[model samples]
Target chain A: MSEIRRRDPRREWIARNRLHRDHVSVLAVLGQGNTPSEWLGPNGVMRRNPHAVGFIGPNGLKRIDRSGGQQGGPATVATGTAASDSRQAVTIEAPAFLVAVVPDMSGGRLSSHDRDLLGLARQLADADPARPGAVLAVLFGSHKEEALGEAGVDRLLHLGDDAYEGYAPEARLAVLAAVERDLAPRHWLLPDSPLGGADLGRRLAARLGERPATGVWQLEADAEARGKNGSGWRCTARGAANTRDFLRPLPRVALALAECAEPVSETRHAAEPVTLAQPLPVLLSRIADLGPVAVDPAGVALAEAGFILSAGNGVTDWEGFHHAAKLLGATQGASRVAVDDGHMPRHRQVGATGTWVTARVYVAVGISGAIQHLQGIQSCDKVVAINRDPGCDMIKRADLAVIGDAALVLQALVTLVEQEREEKRHAA
Target chain B: MRPDPQKSPSLAITVLVSVGCHPLTGRGRRADQDARGVELARALPLAEVRLLHAGVLDAGSDAALRGYLGMGFDALTLIEQPESSDVVPALAEVLADHPPTLVIAGTRAERGEASGLLPYLLAERLGWPLVAAVAEVEGVEGGVATLLQALPRGQRRRLQVRLPAILTVDSAAPAPRQSAFGPARRGQLAVHEVGEAVPDAELVEWVEQPARKRPKRLKIVKAASARDRFKAAAAKAEGGSGQVLDGVTPEQGAEAILKLLKEEGVLRR
Candidate 1:
């Protein structure tokens, strides 16, 4: 069976002949692989035997292309797509009560953190299907977010008035007060983020005299603490600079972390417009918004940097590193050695002993990552290393490692980035 | 009460400090934000800064409180409050008694519940304007404080909060200066006997355990058919061993890095 057998000429000719009526059946009679596969059934159907077609791969896994490419009938490529999404449009016309959510809406868009907060709102709202509670999203100021309904908001109370804009926590809190009086929401959920939710949420909780549960990461039904009405929910929240966890009863107001619960991906809600029954009261505010200050990204704190350009002892060309960081518009971070050498400020140090950074993209230029440095950047989504030594721990941890002189690599990168920017500008 | 606005009056700044717990090792330390608040207070020109704390002084808390005093303070006022009691009332009362020109504090403590509701609650109780997430207090002029408030992604908003305003220092604020050993050792902890302990009603009811690691979310492919699911399941886990570009020219390495930056959507046009 291992040897390549000479084909029978008569059968081959018959199978090749288009005019032959038995040609189709004869084709099937010609088995596929090293082993005989299948035969033509009496009803003119080809019975497939898959084991005969495929060979075991190097890792001892069976490899087979079920696209019918072996004996092509236009290859039954099953690139099947779902006709429609899994999302179901839901409307809670007469909700028993309301659960309010106030999103940060930074840059006039609902951030991922906002979406997660809304997800938590949905959980509390849809906890009991028998008497579903609607999620009322109080969106102050102007927001460009289009899919409020898709984000699991049942009622959208948008106050696009100029008064609700920037640094107007007083006016925003007034609107929230109106919400508390009118809707009397059962629960208020906000993101435990610094953008706006943390500030506004804390104010809302304080103004309402409700003790809030901040940094809540998870919620669970406590059977032992179940009330007469229904199952009472408890939560685990980060405490004391995130050193400890506090298990506390789910408060009327809950400031949750990102991914506390998954974002609403399975359902779309009716984003019905809501208005306060009574006109909003004008509260005299002592605080005034002077607009935003123009700050260099490099001067920003390492903990909040979305992208970081970090330097270490191996970075001999300090001037070039700074230039590259500026060109890249990244926050500056440094290793302990760099800081100790007076190259970078103490505040710019990145490590367990320094500031724990959660940068999305951390580029370590010439850094031999110490354990503390790695610990500080553990929350970073991706790390890119440009190092002279390939065996450095930073290189091992990096998703992409460029083993070369850090100075040269950074210089070349800056040039490429500039070129790309030029092309983009021209195209635009 | 605010000072008479006739002349260039000196400001009396009160900083509310708290015991902080280290994240890695659960030892007591000066809370980061609170330390920053102290630093912010100290930076204000012509302002006499006073540190206030509301917690029991003990072996564990002693180290934490001393951590605050080590920031070049001769002494810090301490109110003897219990471990699990609400400190808002005691702190609010103290503020009302003294009535400083401005109240500066961290948004939250680094110990206990750390709900970040202290300044807000104090402001509500005192009926004063509260500014949260403050990075820096620029200046005080004509009873108005010009401040820099921290926003997400390192953005800053300038605010003019009327004096007697409560400012909560943001984590993004300038990092606190090192606490010197001399100041820490010499600084005295003045113990003040305060009102009865009011237990945190809600916190006392719930159970607490050492935090279990939050499960990392897996990439869920919403496949329609079994074949797609099979394909997704059989796919190798990505980034197991990173792509190392060794022996490549700097240009090639840069090009690769640029590509990755583009793919990550981090490179701005």
Candidate 2:
């Protein structure tokens, strides 16, 4: 039988490799040498650099011994280091800056950073010109082409494995640690949307004992502003505080009240031409030197009506999911429950680690108001929460809280809305 | 009903609320938002209920969590996966040594890595039948335990699982019980350390944490008259005044509206 000739997905990879001929050094941790098209653009450009390298434990990898070599054969065994060129890990010098096209899940689709993420990336790129920039992105099985087209990226990394998707907290963190140790970029850039990326950044920052910031609309630095230690960089950014409420406020207090809301505007999506004078640094683990990932060349997934009837943990059962759906003419969404049950995709998650959405209305049912979850939906114009516990964190954050079971509250609300619609029909 | 000896033998049920987002680089979850898996975990009738806050822990938050841990469980276990967003390893650690007959968590974390992948992952890893979105877990009987599962459209289903199985309790399970101040204050938290070290990343600048927003109030309290009865009557009558102009030209209707507004002192002539 003739062996089937498999087409090399790396043909475009080789063409894309032509651009990186000038790059003298490249570092990849956990390099799998997988098909390049999955991680790169159709033309072979890399996208979604989601892996980094850090010091992993000694036993992190499987040990290999020489099979049946003679006395003088290659050393019987070799110790692998996190930075070793082994398939499991590798090490290299830190790049000038780390550029990640941080995944934004707002509107249930992949999006680029508003002015904030770009500003930070540009500022960091300008900070040091010698080292490469590392671009990291999260791909939700779709958006492969769009991710590769994101502006200001060098190498693209992909961190999607069937098992990794099912990762628990420890396995998830391990991958991050590995990514950190491999690509030691000076400056790390991420989008402000919820998804584990920015939180990982914060945790990574805390682990490294560095200060972190949020809601940074823009970033700037004086060329002369040096780090206190004279070895790092200094930068500043514009931050915002938005408030969300279900009720339209008295004009006087509305502005003050507005401080708690999440930003309602989603990231703009366009296939506009972006000029790249020079390649930005993109370092990722597993794949070597995949370059210049793009922003959502593909549009994101969003609801047309600009409304979300979101359920939180407060929703004790599917009954709540049903009730909330009826009251607002909303599509049923779970706070990971729907996704975990295989009803929805992880891309639809709304929280710090999932997608960030600011619809006109976000009705949170059975959800406790946590700061992280608030970060995702606070931009919505109005928010309502229902729970038996009036003091659940969500109650204080909600525009209105009906103190009852989510099911009961949703049923009552559905009836009220239905009656209103019926009366309007009759009057008409 | 008599309890089945094999079903309840040395079996301990524990609920683990998965908090924190799935780790993707670039964005963070909201500060005030979460899936409230903690409440779901508390609702389960188990030997212990643990809320795992895997998101970025701001400064001075340990005491707050410790306070909550003191409420009532045998121990409040803190699973720390420093600087990493992957939760599978932590779940692996827990199930490896202390495999509970039943394990429950939110579908996803509140902040990073909000993939809602833990329950499936745990079930697959443990090779257990995962009853997701479970509403109620009846006691062990005849070597099997019955669980009320929440189906779509507010429906429910019952399933019986053998002992030593994993079940993911969803928000559709039942109303999570309220945490009383007393139990919350007295519960003892036994902090368990996972063996992963956080890496050192560069620090740029500290952005001042923004304040969370509160709900808003109404702009106008429209009352036509001072008396409550009069106000109610006026409100009822306000919607009845518009006259239908079925055959009248739009121009004529506009002119009539303009004249009425002028007479009422609403518009200038």
Candidate 3:
């Protein structure tokens, strides 16, 4: 076999080096020498370094051992004068816990966001092999204790009261700030739910004077090896085109997105219930519960919907499109063209510049699946595209492609659904 | 609670404007932050609103800065600083010299080192209470302002914060009116010089790679039974199989979809 010549500069560089390209890129970008320094203390391990800045990497802070030998397994906290010096600056109360501020699940069930936070807490606890911390679930309202225990929460701090019924950011902030002051946890984790998590996280961070990484999807912590300076957390946030990783010292707060971390299996941990010493301070007085306002059924927010029936330019029969959506109990969504053409309201538009949806099932009716439109539905689990053109991007990306007139397909589906429901009722 | 009309005279609103860069195109445009910030400031009836921008003026940024000017503002105070310099210290200095009753800004700039850390860092520097995601300013009275904060899913919360606080506007804030060309052409861009230049700590190497489609996230399955677990694993491994359904009747296609939906558990019988 003849050796093939590569044209691309990046590929050629990788081929010449024969080393991990990411590691080489980090060294080249930071202008660091390629002498593998055994920098971690005995038992300390360097996971992976993407881009290096001084001691910081994509993973975490790296300690450079000038002695030059990769003899250590994973860096463990070495007892020495340097460690003592690092510890002298800050005093930490032992038995540090990973606290997750979780909201009351609407129906007493754990949301995926809740699960991600629990998983994050577990990871943070496991990071510190020396003194494995406990995962604390701070519940704003009453929840199923069994679910919390099964989610691997070691402790449950329940703040159940009539006043804490609905989502109140101010009240939650007061309680969380007080909890932080009382418990003094090493890490405070929150899901980046706009309902309250993002707001609460930012407010708590501001209150505690800690810089937080919001909408973080990946995070790693070194809680066990608390040098004089204490441990630090490395958070990775995904942007449109790039990924940005932030490294902040321990006693920090972060808001992780719902789907960021892989949730671990439910563990049966003995849940120890605790209460706040002081009552939650009343920051604001509620004037009245106005109840839910009436909104147009056709104009539903795309982001919150579990199932969406989206219409595009190809959708001419608005009545059929809406009827199908109603019959299937799916929220109506429109592409930019549909909204621009006044077929649907502006709020119903879903794309890059419009609402982003993470629905369980997204049915595209007549949507050509433009890049922007696809971007909006990227998080959708199962996509069923109905398009006239067989070669359209929508058909290629969909889990199920129905090559037919969108109106006919939608009408048929709606009729079939209605008939099935009627038959089931009669059979019962 | 309603804000008192009598105390409106003492209110002074300062809106901070920054260059918003488009992430994908890298084009300098009127930032969504400044647009919302400007609109929020304009909404206040009795308060005197001043527009401020911090950075050395360039052709790309001047155009974006003028966007605020186009929205009926006469002049924008540009605190001259290098693009690479940290604007926090300079911003704090200017803010200290001419302290306003309330400071409003966008949550974060869109382009170039969009850390979303400015509001938090600025609040820390000024030692002021920071309020995020403000949808509307309900009222300001007696050194306190009533704000309707935006929550996820169109819910709003009424919050009262003491004056001399910093607020970052969310997208839920009323959409800004289109900028008039005549006013934008006539608006003044006043520049102020600062003493020091803070060196930029370019920690993360930002390589502009072509945007790639995001990989599908693994669905978290919590099945207890072995059969259920096996089914879930198989579904994930297969990545979903589908038929093209070419030349098929609408009835047949609907049936196929219904079967798939039932298999995926998206629909109930």
The TM-score each candidate achieves on chain A is: 0.59, 0.34, 0.49
User: What is the C-alpha lDDT profile of model 1 across A1-428, one tens digit per residue?
Assistant: 66975657677566546478867677667742224355444445676666666556667877675534322222222221223345788999999989999988865778788898898889888888999999999988777789999999999899999998888988888888889998999988988887577888899899998788899999988765467224378888987666678886777888989889888988989999988999987778899999877668966768888789999998999999999999988889999999999999999999999999988789999898888888888888779999988777888889999999999999999998888889988999
lDDT by residue for model 3 over B155-185, one digit each (tens)? 4667777668989899889999898888898
Structural similarity to truth (TM-score) of each candidate: 0.69, 0.33, 0.58
Which prediction has the highest lDDT against the true structure? 1
**For model 3, how does the per-residue alpha-carbon lDDT over A1-428 read when each residue is reduced to its tens digit?**
66983334553344235366575665445343453232222233443333322243346756443232212312222323333443222111234565555643643556777886788877887665677677777877766536566566777787777666554655677778888878877778877665456656766786787756665665655554255346555556543224333343334687777766666563455457777777766665322222333333344467967678899999989988877777676788989999998888898889898999977789899998888988898877779988999988888778999999988988889889999999999999
Which 10 successive residues of model 1 chain A have the least lDDT summed? A72-81
Report the C-alpha lDDT of model 2 over B1-269, residue by residue, as the tens digit: 22354664444555564322223432332221122334444444433444444423543445445444433444556666555445556666767787766665654344332333455556556655544455566565554676665432233455666656655555454444344566555665455677674342321123233333423533244332245344565552122222323343333433433333233221111
Q: Which residue ranges in model 2 land beyond 4 Å of their true spot? A: A1-98, A105-115, A128-140, A144-150, A154-184, A196-231, A234-428, B1-38, B45-47, B50-176, B180-269
Q: Lowest summed lDDT over 10 consecutive residues: which window, candidate 2 chain B?
A: B260-269
Candidate DockQ scores, in order = 0.39, 0.01, 0.12
Task: Please give the fraction of native interface contacts (Cα pairs under 8 Å between A and B) kept by each candidate.
Answer: 0.77, 0.00, 0.27
Spell out the clash pairs found in candidate 1: A240-B110
Per-chain TM-score of chain A in candidate 2 equals 0.34
Question: Fnat of candidate 1, please?
Answer: 0.77
Task: Output the number of the TM-score-best candidate.
Answer: 1
